[model samples]
Target: MPAPRIKICGVTQAATLHACIAARADYVGFNFCPPSPRFLSLPAARDLGAQANGRITRVGLFVDADPATIAEAVEAAGLDAIQLHGSEAPQTVAALKARHGLPVWKVISVSGAADLAPAARYAQAADLVLLDAKTPKGALAGGLGLKFDWTLLAAWRPSGPWGLAGGLNPANVAEAVRVTGAPLVDTASGVETAPGVKDMDLIAAFCQAARS
Candidate 1:
């Protein structure tokens, strides 16, 4: 199998973004969730977006945000795509895709085989379905560095494009690919030194390890 594509999420600093580019990460995500420690202000995102304009693919991350909010951010950040980590329905995903004319990724919080059922419904609505760990009650939706049973994905076949996230770090990412056959791998807290602080070395190590 080919090496999985790497996406470094929750990028908050210019240095960190540059590090991802230097490491040849396939995508870079900017968090827009207000509760997230790695949240990016529109102004900051605009600058970062301009900096990364043609050098890399920029994805804006949102959690149940309104259409207007997503629209404004897309313009400010010049995002190539938007990732929704919310309770949005398939119609909502499809509507956003039609409204924005960009790829829309729906995040499915998974704990068991049943959780994978939603992927089929979202296949036509979303450009990609991202399977991530389910957070605790009233907790942050994602980026908590929690992982579910990878074997749960073994028997599951995706209806469309998909990716793996949650608790993936440099140490386990390669094995994650081996088991899940995830064509794309994403990391947020996995490469961080703190809640929102991304370590350059860790980013490099993660990219190398994922492709190793």
Candidate 2:
């Protein structure tokens, strides 16, 4: 099996963005959800996204945001894609993809096998489906550092492209790959020194571990 492509989400600093690039992470995510500690301003996202443009795929993370809001952020940041970490329905995901003409990665918050029931619906509209751990009631969308049972993915079969997220760090990532066969692996809180603070060493270690 191929080593999974890596995404370091919730990147807020230029240095962190550069570190993600230097570490050869495939995707660099910027948060636009207002409630998130990792939230990035459109202007800031613009700058950081530009800094990462050619070397990495810049993904803007949103949570049930309006079309105008997503459009404005895409224009400002020149985002290659947008990740929806909200309660958006299937039609809504399709509408956004049609309006923006950009790939939409819908986050599936999984606590069990039943939670994955929405995958087929979402796959029809979303360009990719990212399976992450379910969060608490009324909590912020992502970077919660919670993990679901990896065995639940033993036969996960999304209609289209898929990836894994939540509670993944260097030490456990190789094993995560071994069990899940996820072609893409995403991490946020796992490499953080604090809420919204990413550690350079952890970022490097995570990329290396995922590839091993």
Please give each candidate's TM-score: 0.99, 0.98
**Candidate 1 structure quality by residue, lDDT tens digits, 1-212:** 99998999999899999999999999999999999998999999999999999989999999999999999999999999999999999999989999999999999999989999988999989999999999998999999999999999989989999999999999999999999999999999999989999999999999999999
Candidate 2 per-residue lDDT over residues 172-204, each given as its tens digit: 999999999989999999999899999999999
Could you give the C-alpha RMSD of every candidate to the true structure, in order shown?
0.6, 0.9
Q: What is the lDDT of residue 74 in candidate 1?
A: 98
TM-score of 1: 0.99
Q: What lDDT does each candidate get?
A: 0.95, 0.92
Poorest stretch of ten by lDDT in candidate 2:
153-162
- Give the lDDT of residue 212 in candidate 1: 92
Candidate 1 wrong stretches, greater than 4 Å: none
Q: Which candidate leads the pack in lDDT?
A: 1
Return the top candidate by TM-score. 1
